[model samples]
Target: MPLFKRRDGGSIRDRFEFRDVLGTGAFSKVFLAECKAEPGHLVAVKCIDKKALKGKEESLENEIKVLRKLRHQNIVQLYDTYDEKGYVYLVMELVTGGELFDRIVAKGSYTEKDASHLIRQVLHAVSFMHDNGVVHRDLKPENLLYFNHEEDSKIMISDFGLSKTEDSGVMATACGTPGYVAPEVLQQKPYGKAVDIWSIGVIAYILLCGYPPFYDENDANLFAQIIKGEYEFDAPYWNEISDSAKDFISHLMCCDPDQRFTCEQALAHPWISGNTAYTKDIHGSVASHLKKSLAKRNWKKAYNAAAAIRQLQLLRISSSRAVTGNSSSNGTPPNRPFPV
Candidate 1:
């Protein structure tokens, strides 16, 4: 049989020389490796212990099945697979550009145009996958990788460990990161490609504003926020963002999947189509917001009652902004976090 069909003739240790471990999880460890036969050829080797996979074989099989059939510039390439007595190894492309926000935070100057280009590639890859009947189910910052350390390096969507390939066009699996999970996923309803759209909306929102749409220290509160499909683009954060960009996110984060935008439709959106005209200097505000948000989350325990009152003041300002505009809330409930 061809190598693609099976690499069972010899041990994977004979093929690639393993280097430092890149990452680790409950059942698998990803390591940086070099092809022994082709010196300097680096790859990521994800090794999963069979014993650890006893109950999760379905996920692994689903990942492999989907990856084997996918070939795109934005999606990470799966080079080969090998199985040993106790473990299954996946050989994949090695990416070094780092996660989505890391790169954005690294660049001294970034903008809506740059974010648009990045998301365009992701949408294209997603369009291809949906066209082929595969759903990535899990789309988050950690899963998006860059090909190299260069500022212009390409983004590759990695980590299909939770991906599923189904012909039914709808699935009932409740798996994904808590922060970026779609409303339908939390509701345990049968869903489809629209879930990926929701994830992309969250990503795009962060890209433009440097903060997650829904956030709460309490997981239950966070889930409640997501299930309501309500989030705000407050002033100072969203004031600099373009209306077209906001419109794009509005279409994706809809609570009803049937009403959400599809990949093809998103690609043709005005913000994506006219990216060249977007603001080119949005890094300062976003970076500041990220720093502030991180500091606030980390030092919450140190804040006194005065700080709590200050938070209430911020919400009041947000409310006043709502009232001054003489416009209704963006479907926000009376009890929701005052738009801040």
Candidate 2:
């Protein structure tokens, strides 16, 4: 049985006609729907089968809860929801603009100043989320979207499947994409809103350059590197990036969550305030690397989502078994030195 009651209503289809499929994932299908009363306005309705969400109802419900109350210019808006016998549907704002990376690549000229502006907007949204006691556990390029196909549309943060609200305080779920995840999360430590800041730092590093700060084919190796907070700005790609830009990333990538910058602090940083002249167009170089990066999508990404869920389960089981907090307690030592 669903945790929440369906708001009294007629056939959902009578009021909202599904037009076309927007996207599909393992748990849900997002469709472009037309409103009967406001036919001119179209909304994206995410349909999730109750059977498919048998074990994951908590996450889905938390996502709906967060989306229902949280509203920001850079965050996708949830219009309404319906709890039918077979499935639940969440109606959201329809955004036509493409992914953030694609939009940057399409631009003729992109620069650090441009990157700062983008990060600033993301920070504002994240700041608002934190203020409202919500943490977006999964913050990545794929989750960032533009409002429209317009050249200057604002990026909206989408996909809250892994989000955690204040009610679930000091989350230890260990759920999120591998690369952009905070080190504390990788270590399975009790974490708070700072995880979102770490993710923003990763996004900032990518926005300025075009590739992730941490990249590896070996999952263990990648996790170890993240644990150590080891990363470098390689030649050719990062040669032109400013030190201030790197400094900004450094502030957030600290291994200790206590040392990382909060969204408010990040927003007030000099880089976002235009202290450095990062206006020189890095689009030519960045777009080239970005194209290759996006096309050669990491195989681990598909596996990581499942792995995160498994990791979560393992953690729960371990807690029941009273396993030590140290990652090494599981026998696979997480402290193994990362290959340089």
Candidate 3:
């Protein structure tokens, strides 16, 4: 159940007429619903099965808390939540414009300037989150959704399942998608909001080149590359990308969180704030690479980077217990790394 219950004694079904299913997951289903008071107005309602969420109740509650606190143009809005006997319902903004990469790939004339504008919007939203003490632990292409199906649709960051509030204290949990996750996160070190900046850097790199910065068939190798902050602007693809654009990414993707660009710094970069980002059409190259990379789609399926992180976390726990000679009471890793 959510920390706070706004709806006193009514069901979500009382206000919205549930329609077709938009999508489904292991323990939840998203349905398109129409507001009863306002005809034709639609919203997506996520119905989560309480029984299936046996061990993940806190995760659901955290997502609700974070989403409730966030109010930004680029971030998905949470309208209302309901707790039922068998399920929990979340009413959210209906974003029909699909994924960010899908829109980019479908565009005919994508450019560095266009990518810069997109990143600027994202930075603005993230800056607001940071200011509000919220950190979107996961920021990947899949989590970014278009507000509408218009040609000039704005991007909205969705899915706060892994998000955390500053009040949660120093976050050391190795979370977030593998390719976009920061080095500190992979190293199991205490981290802060700068991790989100690293993810934006990875997204910016992919936006310019249509592929991830660090990738390998082997999960360990990929984590090692990210841990070392090893990536390059390859020839041909990046030959035409502006120097300012590369500089922007380098600052955000820096190995050291302290050295990495903050959201404000990134927003003020020439690439985003100035006109240094080139207008040259990079769609052909970027789209071609995007199709070829299959990118994190494959990685998300075939490899479990989170599992590797969990293994590392487990190793650390074992080492600490050995040094302190305090056996774990439950015989299980504590605070198991949040699902990535």
Candidate 4:
């Protein structure tokens, strides 16, 4: 039973049956859809107007090509694409939960443990992208999505409209979410993948404090604050978080791009060390770590709690399938309602 229903019998290229709208942005609109050939399978169809792709068609094509070649658990998966009559549509995985921004807004702020877990997953996804020669110029909460419900969601980095594939070279595009953009990017300097690390640091700050480290009513003042690297933490929030977590963030947020920690190094930090109860492996691997961390305070406790909830949810979804389903024993379906 899909949550959204198809619209007006409209179909993309006579293949994907358009369900309800998922979301809309400046250049495109996303819809939850089903492939006519594959009835129960669900996907996200991004419909970009031909007018919007006029000057940037090549960039959009490049993003599709790059995403097609990339396959990782942490990164959003692209299934298919087509350009019909006048519209360009990209079919991708339907991460059911929602945007990461919603969760941060709801919680006001996250604990240090939660922040570390989320950052680790983002790092892993970015690291995989960099390894494939793709640089995600846009790294922000809005671009990151949860695959399931908020408490036990898998974070998947999405929206590659501004992404580019760089073969060991620097990119000059001054593009990224405003508050999360790095100083070098703001200065229009040729930058490398390190810019992603800077954005990660900003995300880390927001996750722990409910707002960015540098914010101002005026855009100029905001840029100045970021350029100067001026930031601080209030007592209670700062105290509950571990010193190692703070050190790790400071390292990632280094003003000098050359000095900032890489994704690999960040994963090795002590703040993220320990076994995750929700995952099979110890320390939970970067992606699973973020999901499990958000579900519980301690890794072990959270893992166990998530597992229990998943079992219950599965039983509710289908008792017969709950006994035979091959989906991960750890995750719960996001579309299913859960008690707060």
For this target, which candidate reaches the highest TM-score against the unseen true structure? Answer: 3
Model 2 whole-model lDDT (C-alpha atoms): 0.79
TM accuracy, model 2: 0.88
**Backbone clash count for every predicted candidate, in the order shown:** 0, 0, 0, 3
TM-score of 4: 0.73
Using all chains and alpha carbons, the TM-scores for the candidates as numbered come to 0.83, 0.88, 0.89, 0.73
Provide the lDDT at 213 for model 3: 78
Give the lowest summed-lDDT range of ten residues in model 2: 331-340
Leading candidate by lDDT? 3
> lDDT, candidate 3, residue 227?
71
* Candidate 3 lDDT score at position 88: 90
The CA lDDT at 159 in model 3 is 92
Note the residue pairs that clash in candidate 4: 6-19, 277-303, 278-303
lDDT of 4 by residue, 260-330 (tens): 88888878877665432122122212233234334532322222212333444444532233234343221
How much lDDT does each candidate structure score?
A: 0.77, 0.79, 0.82, 0.66
**For candidate 4, what is the lDDT?**
0.66
Runs of candidate 4 with Cα error greater than 4 angstroms are 1-13, 104-110, 274-340
**Model 1 bad stretches (over 4 Å):** 1-8, 168-170, 275-277, 292-340
